[model samples]
Target: MARLADYFIVVGYDHEKPGSGEGLGKIIQRFPQKDWDDTPFPQGIELFCQPGGWQLSRERKQPTFFVVVLTDIDSDRHYCSCLTFYEAEINLQGTKKEEIEGEAKVSGLIQPAEVFAPKSLVLVSRLYYPEIFRACLGLIYTVYVDSLNVSLESLIANLCACLVPAAGGSQKLFSLGAGDRQLIQTPLHDSLPITGTSVALLFQQLGMSFLPFSMSSCRSL
Candidate 1:
């Protein structure tokens, strides 16, 4: 099965730089950012982090979710990204905080307190399935927080396995197993009338010269 997501990214702020722009935050981690005719990485990061620390602001107390759609200039195909932004702060020692705060740059050194920063995890795909990707991210987040050694790339890969697409639809829509067949019974009220073109095509395939007839004509026959 192929992966639902083309790329998975985690973005976080660099507390040292307090101003706006790309330098304010950096891509903490990402899986597979190589060899694309028009990579969505730059635009994706810009959409999420351009204003700087917006995800971590007080307005976003709850988990924030948004979608970004961009057309690949080369292929002229659209790529969508489902992003979830929330607080994912790393605990740091006072000494580490001092180092990260860059005491050398500051006028006078002072004890640093615990830092809280906004982090965003994004999943990019060719299709738009926000609910599916959101659910997948929930599992990925659980695995991420629970295990320190867990690989993000592996997590995304496993997520793709669970969210594989089936004939352009989500796997959740399919209930059949391997070699299994499902009989779909439709009520006449719900069924659509067969068009003359369809009947003509069928007759042509069967090498029959039968002309198309309506239900009323058949009744009279």
Candidate 2:
């Protein structure tokens, strides 16, 4: 449920503060990232069951949900995500636990790569781990695994820093072949006789390059 956003790009800075006023601080002076204790559950969000109707049945772990909030150092800006976990199980006769305990087995599914993320969570949560997303994310944090001690801001900042490229890096590869074309050139290999009117006369015959007959002399032409 994380957008993996980095707030540093939007944070306060030094030069902006000095120019504003006599006693004011930099406009972009500090970052927005924080740890969980310092950042509280963003207060007063109403939660309800999924609309229209709801049904509950799980072969394994209980359904879990959380609301996360990310904020800046000054608490000026905020972002949030809703995260939920689910189990994935299928009723298959051959795939039962006893049949595959010591045997080599393989399973396959036909779907797009986009579906793998969601399906993977279901697959793991249904059979092996009940809390697949939280469990996997827990391995990432060396301290306080699954305690949710990390603030939404810090989580977003770190995730974005890992996945997103910096602003100017994207254009580097595309510009490598630039300047290969000759925009303004004179032919050093050719011999040419030039007169001011002679150059104009040549393309005029071709008709594509020259727009003749001025409006000032329209009737005469």
Candidate 3:
């Protein structure tokens, strides 16, 4: 049960330079920034769970979930990314509070940064490695940016519009199957600007799923 088009596309870089919150605190100290009481698995990016719920298991059908991209050199030249979610709520109480009688409990909440974006700053100096999104999953991660200027078809059309496809125009892409196997590759030549209107106000502060990728392909993966 691996939806969200499956998931996979985590590039990295940022050996130090880039300031203003120090490139999102070094991309959250190399992907390990899970807040909200930690439980939502998926360290760096790409998270869309629902199958068996609870970080689903059974030899992992689809697991990886974490996406943090940072490059905020101070202000407008923004470049930040963070996505994490694991939410469930249903808590009610009233066992004689005022003479009535109540009991309804079901609580669970782990919404890390949720989601945040602000690409541009020329796509993080034409992003080349940024850190390969921390690798793992079929492994092939790559990264190597050293003064890159920009223009590899506008950095592959802004990373093919941040690839999140799967319905029809297939393009795999998912993560969280366990780390270090090696296959995720990285290497670009260029690329944004209000950091793209604060990346739509950081995807509305993280309740993402703008769904696109040609309507998320159509489903099934």
Question: Tens digit of lDDT per residue, candidate 3, span 88-130?
Answer: 2222321323222367544443333222222111112222223
Worst 10 residues of 3 by lDDT: 187-196
In TM-score terms, which candidate is top?
1
Report, for every candidate in turn, its global Cα lDDT versus the true structure: 0.50, 0.27, 0.27
TM-score of each: 0.52, 0.18, 0.19
Residue pairs with clashing backbones, model 2 = 12-28, 12-29, 13-28, 13-29, 17-26, 17-27, 32-72, 32-73, 88-126
Candidate with the larger TM-score of 2 and 3 = 3
Give per-residue CA lDDT, model 1, range 80-151, as digits (tens).
454444564544433432233544544334444444456767777665556556666665666665675566
Cand. 3 Cα-lDDT? 0.27
Query: Candidate order by TM-score, highest to lowest?
Result: 1, 3, 2
Best by lDDT: 1
- The residue-by-residue lDDT of candidate 2 on 140-207, one tens digit each, is 23222246454534543343332212221121111102121211111111222111123444445666
